[model samples]
Target: MSNELYHKCHEAISQGRAILEDLQQWDFETIIQYPQAEPQSTASHLSTTAMPSTEKTTLAEMESGLKGCSLCSLAKQRKNIVFGAGNPRARVVLVGEAPGREEDEQGIPFIGEAGKLLDKILLAMKLSREEVYICNVLKCHPPGNRDPQPDEISACEPFLKQQLALIKPELIITLGRFAAQELLKTTQPIGKLRGQWHEYEGIPLMPTFHPAYLLRNPSGKRPVWEDMKKVMQRLG
Candidate 1:
């Protein structure tokens, strides 16, 4: 097998082991709840006026309508807008920072190596991609895989808000610093934000390290698995 394939297999094994350990330690009766962070202000950047007319109900319709969007400069470089995917009625939604190279190319959210890691994580939770919707804060990828700019997020957040309104998910998991910070409207770093419960538009939100970060720093898998356990329990 190629070196890349070999490393991926090894990483999977390590992650699986961590998951098993977490499961072994889990107690169905004894709930371990983290302290709730301060409630974030519910003031939305996107008002009712920003919502598309009632005619655009389905995600497909919204995506189609946004085909020629040039709300931000990122649209200029994007091959395709990585619109969200998975079960429309999914109880959980995973939001990341923005589309990566692979995601941008495929016009699918979380379809890259990070996405594979995410699939493994969902499996660990006894969940599948089909069970949860996945998308990013920014649909179009930034140039050179850079961090999303404020203007870009401002231009894109309305659509994300619309998506949440449609999905009305029971819970949201924000991956990476940007996703968590942006949604919560906080300046706290991901390290402090993660492992604690927060809220977004009344739905429970959990912030955790992104799968891409875990790939770079495999040691982070343990904490991420812990976070997933909390998510599973909350969902149940």
Candidate 2:
């Protein structure tokens, strides 16, 4: 595929993830008011800026707000957006870094080999995909499967905040260094980040190695399992 076409595919993937991020917001209502003559120009508030204040919010409406967003350049190269799947009101939520090549292609989080392993891990937790909501810090795949850029994360923050605000999950499990670090707003390494409980928006967060990491270092699986067991114990 030509470079232009390839990048366009990634842009679409981003759009897909943004839609998924907003899907569950349909369950809750936010106050909506008419906008003024001119809205402020802010990348972080891209979605809300275009729309009036919402008393009742829907994922569809949220998605509409994000339409035509160019808060960051990532939008230009995206093919589709990947959204979270499963229960909207789930008690647990899992956050990852960004879409991989496979995730971007499918516009679904965790559908690749790593996702398959995540499935098994969920099974070990005595949970199914239906019981939780899954998403990434970035809705779109980073070009070349690289780590998410700071500007991209900044642009996408509102979508994530809205999801957390709406779902109000009892526990949040962060996968990988970026997800954990970004959520924690710390530069600490994943080694220091994992194996403990952190807080985000008043919800309990547990950091663990990404399935991709476990694939690279099989020894990491045991710790991830231990972390899940802690999460299971906490749920009880």
Candidate 3:
């Protein structure tokens, strides 16, 4: 082994010994060590070498991976993979439920009239779609715009988690009850979830009415505006 590899082995042993000492009640002798055999070429060894880095897979790579994914039944009926699009390094990420007719057709989230409303709302805050990331809980659209089944959400959750990990947003704004409930893992209604700051995997989450819902209930815009104010304050 190289000097670096020797040092790494020593550090690992020291850490293991510390853990064993701390957990005195447990048997540490049962620990297993699996060694990887060396490859033939220097290129192969370089490929296998581990590096300390935080960069994640690109959004395009993620979408490509999901293109053929059949993790849930939604894959069968989906006309397109609404894999989400926007700035990958966005500070804010807007999460919604599943796709609708336009979204399914275009393979993008938050399109059509609802999307238009979202655009206006963002403009009012002096932000544009290019400035933030947008995605849905389900990458594929549920037929007839129905609520995503629990199993479907579970199947597609890892993609969302990966997107979050890659974006590493300072704030996440969930639209509608389903988005809030699914991301926050709470059964609370939108009314209860809104107007207060919450945390999802350590990132600040703000739940508010969906743009489609806002189109239906224009009166509720007041509270949504309140929630938006909080988001802007934090982002500022």
The TM-score of candidate 1 is 0.77
TM-score of 2: 0.75
lDDT tens digits by residue: candidate 3, 119-138: 98899888999999999998
Give the per-residue lDDT of model 2 (tens digit) for 10-67. 9999999787678546432244465565655554444443332223265545555554
lDDT of 2: 0.82
All models, RMSD in angstroms: 22.8, 12.6, 13.6
TM, every model: 0.77, 0.75, 0.76
All candidates' lDDT scores? Answer: 0.85, 0.82, 0.83
Error of 1 at 87 (Å): 0.8
Which candidate's lDDT is highest? 1
Clashes of each: 0, 34, 0
lDDT of 1 by residue, 31-102 (tens): 344456655433321221122322468887778767656667776688999889998899999999999999
lDDT of 3 at 159: 82
